[model samples]
Target: MIDSDLPLLNLRDICKSYGSTPVLNGVSLALNGGQTLALTGESGSGKSTLLHLAAGLDQPSDGSVHLDGEDIGRLDDAGRAQIRRDRIGLIFQQFNLVPSLNVAANVALQAQMANRFDAAFTAEISDRLGLSDLGARYPEQLSGGQQQRVAIARALAPRPELILADEPTGNLDEETGDIVLTLLLELVAETGAALMMVTHSPRLAQRLSREVHLSRGQLAVQ
Candidate 1:
């Protein structure tokens, strides 16, 4: 069972550096269930790095990251990978879908890998994301919006505890991006999952419950 009082994600004095160049310095934050946090920053502000640390994709050079009360930084590579696979959902601006796979297959891929595929849940997510009719189509067959929907569906299919989205709607027009953002937030709300999305758009960030700004490797609440 998930602890409601405890933060779903916790970062404490997190720091990262590439060689001698510091990327993130003493960053800390907390996220609770069903909370949506928009991480806003200019280019090279370490927003992506913070997300990667939260996802356990990269280890912090100093400090700790706790997900569900477990210190992810202490886990081994395989362990971290398993945690990422099982507990975190990641959405990228590029809409990283397998070109050959149809929508249904791509959406079900992670659940299949985790051996937690649920046909009913998958169907529900597909329908909710407006991908029900396009399940048989390949990634190339879809438009930018459609492809993004597929990515969102895939992320939610696994029922992860946390969702990390990096510029999820960056490539789309304002109207399309708004639609996608609405859908994504609705899904996150329905699932009661924690979400931290990196975006440069202040308008988009305003939709979230809270906003955090990253500037020169430091985090500031906004």
Candidate 2:
């Protein structure tokens, strides 16, 4: 049974396909606030696809996705965009920051778009992510780890209810990746936000509260 005490993130019989190719087939899972769920799978196993669906970045062919009791799958495009803008935070391995913008602007960009920019909170997040001294630096000036940190800071600055991370440490070396993962989890815990991270590393998955394996688009408890 799903726990009611925790904030809810529910996916029911989710299905996705690209033409005749099925990526996620009847997958289902639930994540709660202050909880970290690791999604692991081999290449092409649909881990990233599931994360995208959960974040409302893409729609499932059939199924329902609910966040905090609201069914996101049923929302219109504009509605989905609003949810993404206001309540959902996404981090990617690519560190999709605007190169022209310095760290502070990049971190505050999303919050500003959502009209939720709080200078004090942004500053706090920057410090927590160890990005205070780099605020004036551009993405190009930072190293891989630092770039990822900026991405993390950007995602957390809005204080979203949920954070969806797709291979957040995929680009880093083992040591750097571990450090970045540590900070990600620490920040998530401090904010009391739910995190769903898609990764292929068993070590990383083990660090989470729960590990889920995705094979041929189906979720299996690990």
Residue runs of model 2 more than 4 Å from their true location after superposition: 1-7
lDDT of 2: 0.85
Per-residue accuracy of model 1 over 1-222 as CA lDDT, tens digit each: 468878999999999999999999999999998999999988998999999999998999999999989998889999999987788888977788999899999999988887778999999888876789998999989998789888877887888889999998886778867876886687679878899999989999999999999999997666
At residue 41, what lDDT does model 2 achieve? 84
Lowest summed lDDT across 10 adjacent residues in model 1 is found at: 179-188
lDDT of each: 0.88, 0.85
lDDT, residue 214, candidate 1: 92
lDDT per residue for candidate 2 within 112-155, as digits (tens), equals 99888999988987876678999899999999888987887788
Flag clash pairs in model 2: none
Against the true structure, candidate 1 reaches a TM-score of: 0.91
